[model samples]
Target: MASSNWISGIVVCTLIASCLFVVAGIIGIVLGPHILQSQVEKQLPLTADSDQLDSWSTPPVPIYLQFWLWECVNVGEVLRGAKPYVVQRGPFTYLEHRTKTGVYFNDNYTVTYRQPISYTFVPEKSALPETTRITMVNTPIVTIVALLRNQSAKTQEIFNIVKNFFNETLFIDHTAREWIWGYEDPLLKAAKSLPIIKDLVPDDHFGYFYGSNATDDGLYTVFTGEDHINQLNNINKWNGISSLPYWRTPWGNQINGTDGSWFPPLIGKDLQSIRLYLYSTDICRSLYAKFEKHSSVLDIPTELFSIPAEIFLNSTLNPDNIAFGTTDSGVLDVSVCRQGAPIYISLPHLLYAADRYQSRLEGIEPDAPIHRTIFEVEPHTGLVLSAQKRLQINVFLQPEHFIDDFKYISEVVLPAIWINESTTIDQKSADDLNNQVLRFFTIVRWVSIVLIPIGIVIFIVTIVLFKKHRSREESTPLLFAEANNTIASDHDH
Candidate 1:
C-alpha cells in the first residue's frame, strides 16, 4: 500500500511538471506573434485614411446650387470668371457626364437596354459643345469604371450614337488599345473634327479611350476597362498584404507623405513658396529650380516655406498628357474646384483608403468630397485672391471608416508631423486626448508582454524551490534513520 501510494505521488508530480512546460511553451508561442505584430504596427508611420481630416466635412452648398451645378453652370463661364478675362470659344463640345453611367435617351428600358450615366462615375473630359453651359462634370473615374465593367458594348454603341447625334462626342473608352486615331488613320484625314483624349492607357490590359474638349491646356487620362475592373474586384486580395493598390500623385509620388493634415495657415510668407516640397511633383521641381532666387524670404533655416508651390487651376493649366481636359486626350480631369482652385490629388491613395474605410463601414457614409483652394499673388502685389471649391465623390466613406482610417494613416501611408505654424495647445490637447485612448491599448500590450516572461520565470523558480524542498525532506528522514541505527549499534557493542 505504501509503495503504491509512493508510485501514485510520483506519477502526479511528473504530470504536473509536463503540464507546466507545455503551458509555458504554448503561451510564449501564441502570444509572441500577436505582440510582435502589434509592436510592428505601432512603429509604422501614419497611413492613408488614418488622419482626422479623413472625416472632416465641408459646409454644404445649398440644394439649389447642387442642381444648378449640373443643370445651368457653364464650365467656360466659371473658367473665364476665374481667369479675369474671357478667352476664345473652344472647339470640342463639352458635356459633363456627372453620373457614373452617362445618360442616354432611348425609347425602351428593356431588351436593347441603355443605361445613362449614373452618379457613380466622374470622368473629366472636355464637355461636348451640345451639353456645354448646361451640365457640369462631377463624376469620378471609378464611377465610369463601374458603369463599363460588363457593359462595354453598350458603352461603345452609346459613344457612337452620341457622336452621330450631337455631331461631336467625347467619351472615355473602357478599352482603348491604340490611340483613338491610331486605327482610323483614313477617317482622320476626311473628318472635320477630332475627339479629345483625356485619359491615357496606364497598362496594356485592354484598349480604352476617353475624349475631352474643354481647353487646349487640359489633361486627358485613360483607364483600361479590364485593368480597372480587375483592380476593383481584387482589391480585397491586398488586405493585410502590403503593396497592391499602388498610387501616384501628380507630383510623381508612389506614396503621399503628409505627416499631418493641420496644414499651416498661409501668412507672411508667399503662399507660392514651397518648402518640404515633395520631391515628386513637377511644381516642386519647378519651384526648387528657382530656389536660389527666393533665398531672402525663403523661410530660411527651416526650409518649410522656401519656395512657393503653385497648383494651377484645371482650366488655366496645360494638361496635355494627363487627364481632365476637353481638347486634349491625356489624363482624366478628376480635378475639382471647391471655391475655385484645382485640388491636385493622389488617385490610388484616395481610392484604396476610401475603399478600405468604406468596406469597414458597409455603406454608412458613402461619399468623400474633395476640396481645393488657390491663393494667387500678382508678381509684386503680395496676395491677390483666394478661392476654394469642392470635389464630389459619388460614394463617401462612413464615419466609422473615417475615424478608423487613422490606423492606415498612422501605420502605413503617412505619419503625422508638426509643420510650420499650425501647432497650438488647443490642438495639442485634442491630440493628447486621442493619444490617451491609443495609449490604453499600448499599455495593455506592454503589460502582457512583461507579465508573460515574468510568469514563466516565477513558475520556473517555484518548481525549482519545490524540488529542492522535496530533496531536503527526503534526505532528512534518511539521515535520522542512519543516526538512530548507528546509536543502536554502538549500544549493542
Candidate 2:
C-alpha cells in the first residue's frame, strides 16, 4: 500500500512538471522563426575559388576512361550543384575479359620460316571488349595510369622508382625522369633508358603507364578501333610518347584496326599531369590510430593504385600540423613523411599551371576537383606561406590501343566499380559531422514541441483543483457565520 501511494505521488508530480514544460515549449515555438532566420542569414561560401589557379589541356586525343577509386574528402556532389560523380558504366568497365583469340604467334619456327600463329592470346585477361561496350552507358569513368618515374634528378634513383612503380603497390615519386614499362618491341633495359623527349619536364615529374595484355615476347598490339591515325596524331600533340624503335608483329596485321606499327609514349610523358588529382581509395590496411574500415576520412594510399605527383603534392598545410588547410594560395602542398622521413612532396598549384597548358591542347573541360583544389592552392599560399615549396607539372601521354586504354574506363564498363564510387561520398567525415549535428538539433526540437502541450494541461488542472477546494471551504465558513448571527438575534428579542 505504501509503495502504491509513493508511485501515485510520483506520477502526479511528473504530470504537473510535464504540463509546465509543454507551456514553455509553446512559447519557444513562437520564437523558432527568429532562431531559424538567424541561422539561415549566416553567410557561407559555396565554392572557394577567389584565388584560382589556371589549368592545362592536351588535344586531338582518343578518349580513354580513367577510373579513380576516390575517397572524396569534401562534399563534391553538393558543391558542384549536382549528384556526386559516379562510374555510370558500373564496375569492371575497364577490366578486359577475353575468352578467345583468333590467332597467336609461335616462336618454334626456324629462321627461314616465320613464326606459326596460335589460336589463343596468352596471359590472364580481364574484361573483354564486347562485354565492356555493352554496358558503356551506365557508369562514370576516368582513364588512370600507373606513374613510374623520378622527377627530381637524373640518377639511378629514377631506376629504383621505375622498378618499384608497379611493384607490390603504388607510390608517387617526385624526381623528374622519363619512364615506361610494357613497350611493344624495344623494351627498356632499366628505368634509366627512358628517353628525355620533352624539354619542359617538371622538377617533380608526373606520368602513368598502363597495358591490358601481358606476355614474354612483347605483348600483342591489342588495338580496338580503326581511328589509329587520329589516336596517333593526338598522342603526338601531348609530347608524351616513346623515342624507341617500333617492331611489327604478325598479329598487328590481324588486329581489327591494324596499322602494323606501334609507338607507345614514354611512361611519364604520355599522360596528362592534371589527371593526377588526389583521390581517396580503400586502404588495404589501416596505419593510423583513427584509420579503420568504418572510419570516414582517408589519406591517399601510396601503396595502392598509382597516383601522380600533380595529385600528391597539390595542397598546403599548417606548419605545426600537416593537415590540409587552404588551396587558395596554390595547389595544395604536402611533405610526405613517415616516422620523420620525408619522401616526396608536390605543389598542386604548379600542376594547375601545367594543367592550363594541357587543357589548351585537349577540348574536354577539367573536372570539378581539378579546378577547385588547384585554384584554391594559389591564394592560400600567397598570403600566409610565402616561402612554400613549388613543384613543376609534367604531362605524359601514351598511345594505348583503343581497346587497351579503354580497359581502365570504369564509367562505361563496371557496375560494381560504380557502386563503390557512389558510396564513397556518404562515408566522408565532413558528411558524418554535418549529419550528426542535424540529427541532434532535430531530436531536441521535436521532444521540446511534444512536451509543451502536456506541460500546459498539467498547469491548468492544478489551478482548477485549487480554486474548487478553496471555494467549497469558504462556503462552509459562511454558512456557520449566518447561523450564529440568527441565534444572536433571537436571544435579543
Candidate 3:
C-alpha cells in the first residue's frame, strides 16, 4: 500500500514536471522570436537618442585612398610621338573622413541619413603635392581666358589684349610636373601663348576636371529603406530603383534581416544575388546621374563575407566593365563631368577602358585585375563588414582644330589617376557580432533539441509510474476480499 501510494505520488510529480517542461518549450517556440525582436528593437538606431544616433547608426569605417597617378615615362618615344603613352606611378595613400548625419525617420519606418562628402586628408604632406592650393589659384585665371577667347571676330582685338595681359602677369606654379599626365602638352602650351589666337587650355586642376564644386558643402543623403527594427519591406510600397538605398534584404525581419548591422539585414541562405543603390557623387553624376548599382550575392564563406573588405574585393560587387559613368551606348560626355575639360572617370589601373586605350599604356600588371573595389558583407545580417571604394580619373585628349602638333597625336582617353578608399570593422565590433549570433543559435539549439527531448522522457516516465500504481491498487483490493472470505469460513467451523 505504501509502495503504491509512493508510486502514485511519483506519477503525479512526473506528470506535472513533464507538463511544465512542455509548456515551457511551447512558450519558447512561440514567444522566443517576439522576445528577441523586442530586445533587438530597443537597441536599434531608431530608438536611440540624439546623442546616441551617431554612435548607433554610423559605423566607424576607415577609408584609405590609394592614388595610382599616370606618369609619362617617355612622351611618345616608343609610340613614335604619334601616340603618347604613360606608366602607372605611386600608390600614394590618403586618409579619408567618412560619417553620416541628418538622420530622420519616416512614418513607414524607413530611415534616411545624410552621407556627407568624404574629406580627404593626407597624413604625410610630402606624399602628394597640395592639389587644392594649385587648383584654387589657377582655375579662375583659366576660366577668364577661356571665356575671353570665345568672343566673335569683332571682339578679337579685345580678346588679344586681355590674353596678353593675363599671360604676361598670370604665371601659375608649374611645380607639379603636369606633362607627366599629359596636362601640359604642346597644344596646351600653344593655347597659353597669346599669338596662337585660340581658347585657353582647359583647366587640369582637380576641382575643375572632377566637378568638385557640388561637393563643396559635402551633403549627400542615403536612405536605409528599412523599418525601425532593422527589417526590410515594412513599407508595402516599392519605390523606383533610384529610391532604393545602398542595402536591402531578401528575407523579412523576423526570419531574416534581423542582423544587427546596417546592410543585408534580412538575407536568406539561398539567395544568389542582391542589389543596392548608392547616391552618386557629383563626379560620378557627370557620367551617370542616377544612383550607382552595388550588386552582390552569396558566393563565399560566411566568415570571409563577414569581413567587408575581403568580400568587396572578391565579390561581383567589383566592376567588371567601364560603363560606370558612360551611357548605355558607351558614349562619354566630357562637358558634363567638367565644363571645358574633357575628363572621364574609370576604375583604378584602367581596368575597364577599351583595349585601344589600355594598349597604349605601359607598366600595367597584365595579371593585376582592374578596379579593385570590394565589399565584405555578413550574409545573415546583410551588413557590410568592410569595403574598398576605388575610382580612376581620366582625360580625353583630342586634336584641337587650331593646335598644330595635336593633329598628329591620336585622340585618346588618357588615364590621369585612380583612388581606392578601403574600410573595415574594428576588432571589438566583430567579436561582439560573433558572440551575439552564437548565443542566439545556442539558445535555439538547447530549446529544440535538448530541452524538448528531456521533457518527452519525463512524460514517458510519468505514464509508466501511473500504470504501475493503478495495477498495485487493483491487485490489493482482490487480495483483501479473498482473506476476509477465508476468515468467515473458519468461524463457521
Indicate which candidate wins on lDDT: 3
Put down candidate 2 lDDT per residue, 1-493, tens digits, no spaces.
5764675576678666866697667655666534543332221111112111111011111112222121112223222322223222211222212222222222321001111111122123213221222211101001112222224334334434443453411112111111111122111232224564112211222122212223211222221112221122111101111221111232211112111111211122222222211111111000111111111122211111122232333234223112332322222222121111111122221233334332322222333233222111111011100011112212222222222232232211111111111111112433443353334445556766877766777667766765675587669889999999999999999
* Candidate 1 per-residue lDDT over residues 410-492, each given as its tens digit: 11111000001111123343344336333444455565566555656665765676678668768988999999999999999
lDDT of 1: 0.26
- Give the winner by TM-score: 3
TM-score: model 3 vs. ground truth: 0.59
lDDT of 1 at 76: 43
How does each model score on lDDT?
Answer: 0.26, 0.26, 0.45
- How far residue 126's Cα lies from its native spot in candidate 3, in Å, is 11
Q: What TM-score would each prediction reach against the true structure?
A: 0.25, 0.28, 0.59
- After TM-score superposition, the amount by which residue 360's alpha carbon in candidate 2 deviates from its true location, in angstroms, is 3.1
Model 3, 1-493: lDDT tens per residue? Answer: 6876776687788888887887787777777655664554444334325333564455565556565566555453422344444565555555555455665565555554544444454547335663422210233333334344466644544544553544522223333324122243332344456544444445423332243211332322233333433343222222222222212222111122222124434333233343332223324321111112334433322322211121112113334223233322212333343545455655555554456666655655422333544455554454566665666666555433222233344555656566666666666766666676536744854685565668889899778867776787789889999999999999999
Better of 2 and 3 by lDDT: 3
Quality of model 2 by C-alpha lDDT: 0.26
